[model samples]
Target chain A: MATLKDVAAKSGVTVTTVSRVLNNRGYISEETRDKVYLAMKELNYQPNEIARSLSKQKSNNIGIIVPHIEHPYFARLIGYLEREAVKKNYKIILCNSHAKFEKEIDYLEMFQSHRVAGIILCSRSVDIGKFVSLNIPVVSIERPVDVGTTSVECDNYQGGILAAKHLIARGCRHLVHFSGIENEAMPADARSKGFIKVCEDNNILHKEVESKADDYLNMEYHSLIESVLKENPEVDGIFASSDLIAAQVIQVARKMNIQVPDQLKIVGFDDVSIASLVSPTITTIHQPIKEMAQEAINCLIKCTEDSVVPSRIQLPVSLIKRETT
Target chain B: MATLKDVAAKSGVTVTTVSRVLNNRGYISEETRDKVYLAMKELNYQPNEIARSLSKQKSNNIGIIVPHIEHPYFARLIGYLEREAVKKNYKIILCNSHAKFEKEIDYLEMFQSHRVAGIILCSRSVDIGKFVSLNIPVVSIERPVDVGTTSVECDNYQGGILAAKHLIARGCRHLVHFSGIENEAMPADARSKGFIKVCEDNNILHKEVESKADDYLNMEYHSLIESVLKENPEVDGIFASSDLIAAQVIQVARKMNIQVPDQLKIVGFDDVSIASLVSPTITTIHQPIKEMAQEAINCLIKCTEDSVVPSRIQLPVSLIKRETT
Candidate 1:
């Protein structure tokens, strides 16, 4: 709790002398350094990092803004990012936007005020205009906002193609894809598009059943699956946008006495933890989450240092064949 | 990027005058305030919050230390805490301990050096000894430490009791509880203790089979469930410490053709999003994550105040029956 001034006063020297000793900047006599050390030890003075950061105009900290921490995918992504951030000797300031525009703007302003070295926008709530105006190196998770910011994302289109191809390999002719959010720049939309493309290329019968769920919440997944099942009674193979959605599909399948991987071969995306934990363990697209997280953090740090890196970095996705497929 | 001195020099005014106008502290004339504002606008002067915080010897930021953010329970809890902290005009600096004692200590020291308002430690890594020397309010979740600090947690004992009573009410004659951890200051242990007590009171044939998993990882759950099934053949009913674990139990049961709620009644703790999303929707104990998170934030804020408030807040828990039990 002791300040530099207190240590200086105790050491009978000016504050500049104490600062020089702390920063090891200027020449100081051995006696003066000893005196300063004694004063610091006596006063229990801890160097104020805030003051140091202010002086350098750069804090060894990064800010991460996410839509919601509660979502498992984002939570896992943040966990990996936090680990990577710490490994790079930088701390993280976490802000939850809750998928709100005003909250995202408030976090950006706050991060600026906090003098964050850079920011990683995991939430796609803010507009491109609001994002580009910050003049900070922002690495977006999914939303490719502007030209200048770096982005780290999984190949959703490839993931979708893999899902449909696996279903076709399993000899499924009739297919229905359950997708949420159509008009957004989300990876799920890309997945749906890829599914359709693959289905069209292979000459397979495919029907798209779109739902208006904001991510994969339980209530939303339940309602969405219920409606999709009601409309498409003869659909055999199902490709869900998220594993959470796929779990819902399985739940609905059980209720309707429809056997999975036989009566219906279901494939999910984002091989989240629950994918393997549940019954008829989900066959999902494994987004290289840890690698992508590390890449995003490294890109942000690089941009903060040099600001010369490309704006977009897309990682590959692969199929994790489990019980469902 | 411009400093106050730059603005002051541009406006031909003293730095003190500019500072006063910026803080709105002194009785400055409207013309003088406008002149300072114009100069600030022209130079794009942004006030340094870090500098101001150093000068004030405090910051409007709180530190949150959690073991892993990927865990659904912790993620939801952190989400709630973040919203509450934002509402209270405080920012959250996140530190992932990764369930390591050294990492927790390192993060604690770093947060202290940064002069964070207070630290809310949701880690189960270290005991009270690691935090006894710190001159900061340390509110822990699930595990209370350093007697004087505030703690906000769910009633784990009651949660355990609720799970046991529900299973008994559903006419479960044989019961077995699975735990990932043996014994620590773990809420799961408390739940286990309560369950054992309830079974004893009712004179039911009760048994406990702890898993080899260290934490709530998916692979851990898989191996744990495999061992549990192999070890306890007469375990007609199961109570897993987490929904993920319970989901694994369901998967294992299905593989062994043990019908849920009919042949093998199972209950999971921490009714996370996956609980309802999974098939044979897990009958589990619901942790009051939102309320507990808000309380943790409020407690940290109160601890940050000059006069710290020391209190132990136990949020309520309940049983949400779906289909498994």
Candidate 2:
């Protein structure tokens, strides 16, 4: 139960100097900082971060809301975001909204009460209007929130274009693009739009099959993929919106006795680890997850500093060729 | 800019009543609580959680330190932990230490300063001595820390036995168990011990191949698995330490033209999503991740309440039969 005054007395410094060292604010000599730390260690003094945050009116915490952490894409994104946040000495308060709007709102209220420096929204279940009145800086990843909220997303449209062009270049005649849930108005929906435009411009026979919300929630698409392949035997190429779906396609193709890269070519997006771990490693669109995460943190910090950052930041994506192509 | 006094005045209540409503402590009528909330909403008053925590000397946060968030096992564990935490109105301060001791220590100090109610240690890199002087409740997951620390873990030893017995029951002779890093006193190492014991009792020829730390961090076990399979062609049954390694084994076997379950029956540990997602779905030992997570949180909470709880909690595991076996 040692107080700040006790540490200052033990370190032979003023209380203000001890507080400055603890806050890491005003510049102090390296020797003085070392003395304070040594005294704290010897006295077993634990500074109250809550009191410090209350005095500063800001906490070194960034609220992160994601739909699901078990999903490979979100898992990778969260990992990269944590790494980037740690570099900036910011901790993340994780909230798994599970794509539930009520849960998202509950977490938002908690973040506000806790006075987090910023919020990084990875779940798109909540409406953009919910954040309109939020005093905290909000940064949405992959999903654009609103005109005032900053968003960091890879070029989903260009990723779709690259996947379609790659499949066509590999001599695919009939192609199918497996999209996410229909009518969601997500930023990722642009991938489907880009795919359709490319197919129409190339004058190639193509079809778009949308996955349901259940498929996403359960991370199970084998049955849907099996049916799609059975009904469309003529389809020789597929562009899946996620690597998880692409992996499922590969599994279904293996069961159907359809030879990949011989009778069919496939491309996946978000080049997560599964894209390469699966056999006949998937050719996928790399979304620059690390860079996107860094940018999201940067945008949130900048917004916290009262700096004007661009509302929309679209990083580039690249097509990674593997055995699937 | 709104204060508690303002909210109390607008609600036609005393400041004490408003404080009680905000803290949900003293008994208050539902109508009066609603009035306080309405007044706060009208005034856009955000109650400062930091100040409240300072007064209470506690925080509704559980600090969680994990090796890697992107790893499937840890990802699923974190998801379940978050769900369990949310149920109890507690938030998680996520720290991905990446199994770095220094980083873990840094996060531990931060957790202490922040006065986290408890800490859930998922990373096993730090020594048990580190938690000896920690004033907060420390619950270790899977790995036992010390006599004072509560640990929640699935029956890893029994899981190893189950996998071996299942493989042997499927008419396999030569067996190989792929273990984690050597010389690490992890709870998972019990799997290797159990596998060896069962093999020895059954008079089955068995070999153990240890995966290096690099194989784990990179999640790349293709070359190691390929080499082992190539060198030990006589090995007809394999028990992998994790589903990730099992998936890689499948990929390597495919490359070597080895038909699974016919030429080589494989069983993996940790029934994560990837187990079923991969073709020739892995037959793994199912760890009750949800139950374990709940138990860990329950233990931490019980400790916080100064209740006597068991030091070690070992949950049951089961064998999941799939195409691999």
Candidate 3:
């Protein structure tokens, strides 16, 4: 936590002199360099590699890889992380992978060539091997890495169970779960599994309806819901993978004149701001967005040091019940 | 635009040499530099300053200043800008002013000290004088700067008049407008003014109830609406400053069992993603977000090149009718 000023004061030199010494740039005496080095060591100061690199390498910027910033969940998550990053005095280069493998790789390579401080991988594309090859600090959001790079994630399985249990408690019998893109990371996949596991344990008959949206706002979700409705008209309970998907379900249900909760209980994931704004509101599982963001920053900061940060750390998820269920 | 590779091929030199020549970095022969410069001019190759700045400044970072990133309006705007920034291979550093003058000043100082290439000011809270003194290219989003800084804003006054006209068309006799914070240099203020002007022209009995929220959340909105309702029970139509605020009106109205469109017609601003997601949807003014973002970026780039960009530019705002009004 020792700042550049602290080290400068301790070393009996100007902040700029200490910065130069730390960066190994500009003309400075060996004695002054030695003094600053000793001062830094004694204070346990880790020069902001990003800042230092930014000053010396001239582009100490890192890229934040996300699927979409417009999505409510991602927007809130980005907001928290942006605040934390600003506090630390690091610039974030935002990358919207748009879930394209080529774009993801392009961003990683761009970050590598541009000399960013680190990579915050919020994208679902799990191509960690390529990132590792770049020899940069990679802190993934939600998606956990197995090879010792820092990661911050939410307990998706727990969130799934919470959603299912809320519906089950509301006396839902013929239930169905609306999932996001299948064959993805543990986050969405785990949520689906948890729902099934909870349904089986509670001895409830359940069916799965996977939506084709990348995350949420897609024309396919409405058609998907319509198709699902045709086959599962008796389905009295529903759990959507996202708030956007849940919003679509609500619209579809309204068109069909099905009253929420009274006729059909519904629960959504990622209790975004829209959850309460929508009519009938929406019961949703709330991921610890601010906490997770802070944790991601903390993990990356830890990675900056020699500390061994966890590769996969799961934060708690809570079910926020509104009017829907 | 011709790429670096195209320039290099025309100049009969390697990409690295062309890059170095464009960046004004490293030692290159005079003849080679001349060739590259001539070739660039011939091909009309615009160098990516971001890529070049990375090598020289150690952080090819662009900072974005928004009032609040959590708000869907700003969030979606940031998302679009982020996407565009990514396309140009630049990283985004987000700073939230929370609509505070002091915070805006702090971020300006921070971004300057942090050596950001440029800043995109989205609804800045700081005075125009401070911005003029920075000697940096700044693109203001939705706020006009008195100084010679480029700005991209929506036609707020027109939007307001349109909303009022819509209410009148809906057979509203007594109308109330929910305005934004006092003395905020936002289009919302102009919107309220336009509403009043339109009402006066039509000889309509209209009342303005300005309810300032601490931020863009539903915190003060509900209470504000309650008080407005108590004071203006005869109010048959409502014009809210934001979609989020409009959604709160729905919540409050439902609590009182007031029928929307039948008893009271409501209209909100900023057709954000949740505008349609919310129940009864929302009949609001649509700000061309994507085009605005691109314009802001283009303006900033022009300013960087010492070009004369407009001090005030207003994009069109359309009234989209959904279910609300």
Candidate 4:
């Protein structure tokens, strides 16, 4: 039941002085140090584990920043990261940016203040310069930063190509690709690029629908798909950027009386659980989420051990054929 | 670019003494303190935030424990809790219990060592006594603890009754209620209690299928539902404890050639995003997840301020009738 204040009062010193003795910090004279120790013994004070990391100028905690854990992609990734961190007796300090620029900045500053051993960022609106200046080991997931910064991502371009090829193989003449909101320079932009390149090479007609950045949590995918379908009524196939968007496409198509596979074949990316949960079992490009998450942690561990780290680690993606295609 | 060691070396004192000066902890002679301060100013050392919290014996952080963040229900709840915690400038240290008892205890001990201001437990396999003994203010979500413990949960009994009433109102004669795994002492058992009471009140034929607690994350709903349906082919109604279960029922029913709403009516609890995402749109009891999360945070803050929190705060649940019912 004894507290730091109780020990302070018993030892004839300020709580700060007692804390200093307990932390083995500050210029505590041998006499004062002995007195503080006697008071702690008499009070049965438990000097907590926090002081170990503080004196060492490091911690066994990894700061993980994501857009939101509620998103399936992020949740699954966090699960894997947690698995790895737990193995090393490292705790996770999780921050949800909630797609806000200010929040991400605040978290970055907080992580720095906490002196977390490392940080894994899946930020959407971060200032790259501020992040690079932190001087902590960082392994970004999906979102690639500048050179010398490590990042782990799936082969998004190959995913796009596989999607396009699958849809085309299913005898689709016209195509529409839904790209979730992205930075002009993000690696995910590569998904649409590959789709466009493949379509262009084959001389197949296609169009790309880019979602606004803010459209993720409050997705207007239904309206977006509805309008695109109305405008491109002749479109026979869709290569959606994500499975959730593809599921939305399926819903809109159902309402529009456009039969999947029979009349409007569709392929989705990121074969998340929802891909199979949906009735038609979405045909998707499966990006090895668990593998990518492991790679990110591995890269972070390597960086944490030293500044040397591979700039990029991209995993392969494969196609999962289902009823939708 | 200067390190703590550098500052200590320049100040002609041990790093512990310099750290003590930086943390304002322990006794330091005026001259020694001034020397450490001058060295810090020279090195431009940024006194980290972690040490400030350590000296204060408190932190602006909450430890959040859940069965698994990848589970939709937990993910959504965590998202709402994160939003509330961030508003108070408190960081969240997240842990997924992964349905393990030891992991829950390990996390609890870790949270104690870190001296978190509070904890919000959505644990499935925790010892209530162990949690209560930590002397930390805790707000348990869904899983109720002993009397005088703070907790926030939906009106589960009402949720069950609503499901039963909806099914009966839709002219369902032969009924079945799927009860998720529950400890006999848990308040969530009230859900099945209400369901059975409603069915008995209506003189309707019904059976309860209890799911094992271990079957949650790796759900065996498909095989379980298949056997139940095979044995009770005339079952025309179902009140599932969670939307995931109801989704499973829909999938099973489809394969069994049973038509939703036309031949069988189903109602589910915890109207998570998946309730609407699934085709046939599950009719579910909406548990007001966001409001519940806010209430949990409010209760924790109250308890942390002055151990005077209410024992229990229950939110209302409503039926969202979609295509399934």
Using lDDT, give the best candidate's number. Answer: 2
| Predicted candidate 4 versus true structure: per-residue lDDT over A194-222, tens digit per residue | 99999999999999888886668664478
What is candidate 4's local distance difference test score? Answer: 0.84
- Give Cα distance to truth, residue A242, candidate 3, Å: 1.1
What C-alpha lDDT values do all the predictions have? Answer: 0.82, 0.90, 0.79, 0.84
Would you estimate the TM-scores of all the predictions?
0.90, 0.96, 0.84, 0.86
lDDT of 3 at B60: 51
- DockQ, candidate no. 4: 0.47
DockQ of each: 0.69, 0.81, 0.34, 0.47
Q: lDDT by residue for model 2 over B240-310, one digit each (tens)?
A: 99999999999899889999979999999999998988888899999999999999999899988989989
Candidate 1 docking band: medium
Clashing pairs in 2: none
- Find the candidate with the highest TM-score and give its number: 2
Candidates 1 and 3, the one with greater DockQ: 1
Query: How would you encode candidate 3's per-residue C-alpha lDDT over B1-325 as one tens digit per residue?
Result: 4688999899999999987886688999999999999998897565544455534443456778887788989888998888777666566777777677787877776666555667888855457565565566777888777576777889999999999999999999899998877655567889998999989989999988765547454334777787788788898999988888888888788877888878989999999877788778889889899999888877766766678888877899999998888
Q: What DockQ does candidate 2 score?
A: 0.81
Return the candidate ranking by DockQ, descending. Answer: 2, 1, 4, 3
Question: Alpha carbon lDDT of residue A193, candidate 4?
Answer: 86
Candidate 4 ranges beyond 4 A from true positions? A1-47, A130-134, A182-185, B1-47, B130-134, B182-188
Per-residue lDDT over B2-85 for candidate 1, one digit per residue giving the tens place of the 0 to 100 score: 788899999889999999998889799988899999999897677888888888877788889987788777887788888888
Using DockQ as the measure, name the better of candidate 1 and candidate 2: 2
Runs off by more than 4 Å, candidate 3: A1-62, A213-220, B1-60, B128-134, B213-220
Model 4 sits at a Cα RMSD from the real structure of: 7.3
Candidate ranking under TM-score, highest first, comes to 2, 1, 4, 3
